[model samples]
Each structure stands twice: as structure tokens, then as C-alpha cells.
Target: MTGDLGNLRYISPWYGGGMPPDPSLPNRRDARRNRDLFIEHAKATFAEHGVDASLERIAREAGLAIGTLYRHFPTRVDLLLAVFEPKLRDFLATAEAALKMADPWEGFLVFLEALCGAQAYDRGFNDFIARRFPRDERTEVMHDRVCQLARSILSRAQAAGVVRPDIAEADLIALLWANSRIAEATRQVAPGVWRRHMHLVIDGFRAGDRHELPEPSLSPEQLYRVMARLGE
Candidate 1:
């Protein structure tokens, strides 16, 4: 991973070379500080404005030039990877932990709560999870892993007769897209309001009272194309 990221040229003279500094080296303290500041500001900026937040605004917030931001994160996706890596790990961990639970129904609910709760807090992360960056191998891998994990969890619940068998990964993705909009609209006025809507959605997913949908779920290939279009 480091080798792949090293291809990005470090343009800041503060690092004394046109190469990215190793944050672990003692001599690169200032460079590390600047990078940290950029990440900190970028997190807050992205949260407020979504992943498409202005890079110039993030640089301004970090008290650095836009070039400095670019020097550290050569592309918007690179900066997004830095900002979202931890949260992504957390979400994956939550899914893993939920999968380990004895009851599939309980595990499914826990997974949804963790996923939706994370989305409710950060709009940028929400966008990141919703779209597919087909050109970025790293993000593509992450997206594929997340989709597989979600499918596994949903399948487990259905096998246990808790979730409707008709429910698909595409349906879950649609829920995420819907939750993102709900979270954005009521972020200030009522942050916790999403919980009500999420619970209602969950109720609809139950096998006992499932209703026939008007349209068919998107196939895996169709879902991929839709997500890719979202990124574009």
C-alpha cells in the first residue's frame, strides 16, 4: 500500500525533497504535523459538505496552501481514503462482530444499527459507502468487501427466517442512499430522527409481514453500474 501511494509526488519544499515523507522519521516532524492538520480539517470539512467538499476550503481551514493539500493527497480519492479508512475499518469490524453473534436476527439488527449510525454522523462517509470508485483499486476492493459482507449478513438473516428472502444487497444499498438524504435533511433540527425511519425500514424487512414490491430488485451487475454512475 505504501509503495502504491508513494507514486504521488510531494511538491512541498518543507519536506526538502519532491518525495513524500515517511511520517515515522524524526526529521519529518513538521511534514507529519502539516499532514495531520490537513487530515483533521479535511475530516470536518468533508463531514459538513460531503466528500465533494472543496479542497481549497479544507486547505484554508488547515492554515495551509492548496498545493500543500495536493502534495499530501494527490487526488480527491486519496484524501477520501485517508479520512475514511478508520471509519471503514470500524464498520467492517462491526459487521464481523455482528456476524459472530449466535442469533442471526439479532446480528442483522446490530449490523444495520452500526452501519446506519455511522452514516448518520458523517455525510462524507455516507457518500463514500454509497458510490463505487471503479478507477481506484483500493476503494474498489473496499467496496467489494463491504458489499460481500452485507450480503452475507442479509443471507444469514433470511436463512434463519427472520429477514424476507426477497431482500437483496441492492435493497440494502437503497436503504443507505435513503438514509443519507434523511440524515442530511434533519442533521441540525433532529439528528436522532433517522432511528425512527431506520427501525420502520427494518420492520418492513421482516419475513412475517413482507409485502410484494412493485418493482424487481437490481441485479448485482445493475447495482454495480448504478453505484459507478453515482461516483461519476
Candidate 2:
């Protein structure tokens, strides 16, 4: 896992790569204020409505025109990247630390706990992690890196004789989807309930004398297509 961790460096493009200068900067002070207002409202709106939240609604909440919103963020993905960049950094940091843990199974558990905790706390992040946006090159790169990390971790656990060899990366993706749903449903009535369920699922995945599953795991291409469809 330590050797594999070195190959998994994922500096987010939003932070490292040069993005275009803020278009609102050249305009009057009011334009800069409007841009700030839009981002503030957008954070709340996306928190409530997920990533597909309406740009027009965000503008309205900001008391700015839709055209102004467009001037600040030409595309939904642009706004999304801005809104999620901080959260993404935090998540990636946690994941990276988990990958460096000495015990493969312990590392896997830490990763899942952090991932699921993020999903449970933020509806927008839950949606963000579950789907694939192929047209957005930066987002696609991030998603692919995340998937690769999951595969590496899973394989490490399997090789360590902790996790079941039959489990695949697709299975972990499926578990993420399941965890998202469970978190959403129980968030209001029982906010911490998902942890119990997750632990039970983890117990099931542990290597032991267990019943053989009849179905095959999804192929890598098949998993990619399925996640893309979910985005659509």
C-alpha cells in the first residue's frame, strides 16, 4: 500500500492548474460583490438541492440577474467546481492519509468511514461521488483517480487475506451508492444509524467461511457506463 500510495498523487486541477482570471475582477466593485453573493447563495442552494441545483434560483437568491451569474460562472460545472473545491480537498486529504495506514484492512475501513461520513453530511457531495460527468475533463480525471485508489486499496486488502477476493471495485461503488441512499433516508430521523449498517456490511465483506455468491461482478467498462448513466 505504501508503494501504491506514491503513485496516487492527486492534486486537484482547481488548486494546482491555472484557471482563468475572475471575469468579474475587471468590472466595478459591484461586479466583484455580485460574484461573492452568487457563490454564497450557491453554496446554500447546492447544499439543499444537490449539484443540479438551479443557477437561476441561485441568482435570484443572490438578488442578482441570471446574466450576471453567467458572467461569473459560464457553465454549471464551473460553479460546481468552485462550490466543491474545498470539500474535495478535505476528502482527498483524508483518503490519502487512509492509504498510508500500515494495515490494509484498517486503511480500508478508515477510507470508507471518511467517505460515507462526507456523503452523510452533504447531499451535494453524495451526488457528486455517485455519478460520472464524462464531458467535464477535470471532474472525469478526479473521478478516475478516486476509482483507481479504491481498486488499489481493495486489492491490497485482498492480498493481505483480510477482504474477500471475490469483491471488486464495482462492488465498492455499489456500496457507496447504497450508503448514500441509507444516509439520505435516515438523515432526518436517525442521523447516526448508517454507521451500524455500514459496520454490518463490513462484517459481511470480511474474509471467512461464507456462502458463495452466484452473480458475477460488473466489468470495469460496465461499471463506468452505469455511473455515466446515473449522471445522465
Candidate 3:
């Protein structure tokens, strides 16, 4: 997988030229340095103010013109993909390794820890995982890959009779939504508390001696709409 905008996996129309050149173009030493600065500043800014952070502020902080920022990253999502590319690779790798574990329950726990731990650190990434950007094919691909991995991880656990039979992919997403709120509220007051909260929820997921849930889990359409609205 592509690591960052410097080496973007999928080149969109916004890149000006077709593939091969890479998204961080212009090739000049100063130009490349400017691009790197934008990405570095953006990484910190987005982590602090989230994906909705100000682009103008990022440019100002980087001592670059706003037009320069736009020239390098035409859109907010473009900047985001660049900033979080490495983290995304780590996440995907974690999920893949989880799937390969011999114990399904252990794999499930490992995946959950990686997933929630990611959200607990970066607010932008928290928003990234929680929302759905339907317009961008790149974000769509990222989301689709995540959903596919999640389903495989969950299904593996369920099939092994380690997870509750009633659990669905939607439930895992619901946990993420809940974790996002918990992380936001308690990040400063008590960092790492989300882990405790996750473990509490995870206990309920285990098979055996379970009471019925009060409501049915969301359908695929409903979940999609919920995530899409979050993007809006």
C-alpha cells in the first residue's frame, strides 16, 4: 500500500497529470521541501483540531502561502490521506495479523485493541474511522477495505463460537462510535481510559450466559446512512 501522498496509491483527477509522477509533484528541491512541511504541520494540526482543522492556519503556521497549500493538496481529504497514510498501513497490518492468529478470540481482542487504541490517540483519525466520505473514491476504497477486514475478523470469531451469535458487523462499528465519544471526553482527564471502557463492552460480547439486547442491531443501509451523515 502507498505510505503517504508522496507515494499515493491511487491518483485522482486532482493530481493534474495521470499516474507515475506521484501526488507530491513539482520535483524541485524547494517545492518538495514545502510539500513535506505542509504534511508535517498538517499531521500535528489535524491531530489536534481533527480533520475539520483550518487549512489557512496550517499554511500560516508552515510559513507558506495558502495557494501553495492548495497547489500541493487541492483538498482537505488530500491532506488527510497524506498525513495518515502511515497510520493506515499500520492499522491494515494489525488487522491482517489478527486474522492470522490461531485463537479467534485472541485475534478479536488484538484487532479491537488496535482499532480502539488508534482512535484514542488522534481526533482526526477518530473522525476518519467514524465518518464516511462517499465522494472520494480513495476514501471509499479505504473504508471498504476496513469494513471488509472488520467483517472477516468478526466472522472468524463468531464462526469459532467465541463471539455471540447475535453480534454483527454493525455492532463493531457501534463500539467505535461509542469509543470516539469516550476518547473525546476523557482524553486529557484520563488518557488510556478508553481501554477500560472497551474491555467492559468486550465482556458483553463473549459467548455464554447472555441476556437479550433491548434493540436489534442496525441494518446495512441504516449503518451506511449513519456513517454518511457523520461525514456531512
TM-score of each: 0.87, 0.85, 0.86
1 or 3, greater by lDDT: 1
Model 1, 43-70: lDDT tens per residue?
Answer: 9988888988999999998999999889
Sorting all predicted structures by TM-score, with the top scorer first, yields: 1, 3, 2
- By lDDT, the better pick of 2 and 3 is 3
Number of backbone collisions per candidate: 0, 0, 0
lDDT of 2 by residue, 1-232 (tens): 8544433433332444335456776677887788889889988888777888888899998998999899989988888888877787788888888888999999999988887888776788777887888999988988887887888888889999999999998888888888878988898899999999888888888998989989999999999999899777
Candidate 1 lowest-lDDT run of ten:
7-16
Q: Compose the digit string of candidate 3's lDDT tens values, residues 1-232.
A: 3356534434553554445644545568788899999999998888888889899999999999999999999988898899987898899999999999999999999999999999787988888887888988999899889999999999999999999989988899999889988988998999889999999999999999999999999987898899999887
lDDT of 2 at 135: 90
Best by TM-score, which number?
Answer: 1
Candidate 2 Cα deviation (angstroms), residue 41:
1.9
Which ranking of candidates, highest lDDT first?
Answer: 1, 3, 2
What's the CA error at residue 219 for candidate 2, in Å? Answer: 1.3
Q: Point out the worst 10-residue segment of candidate 2 by lDDT.
A: 9-18
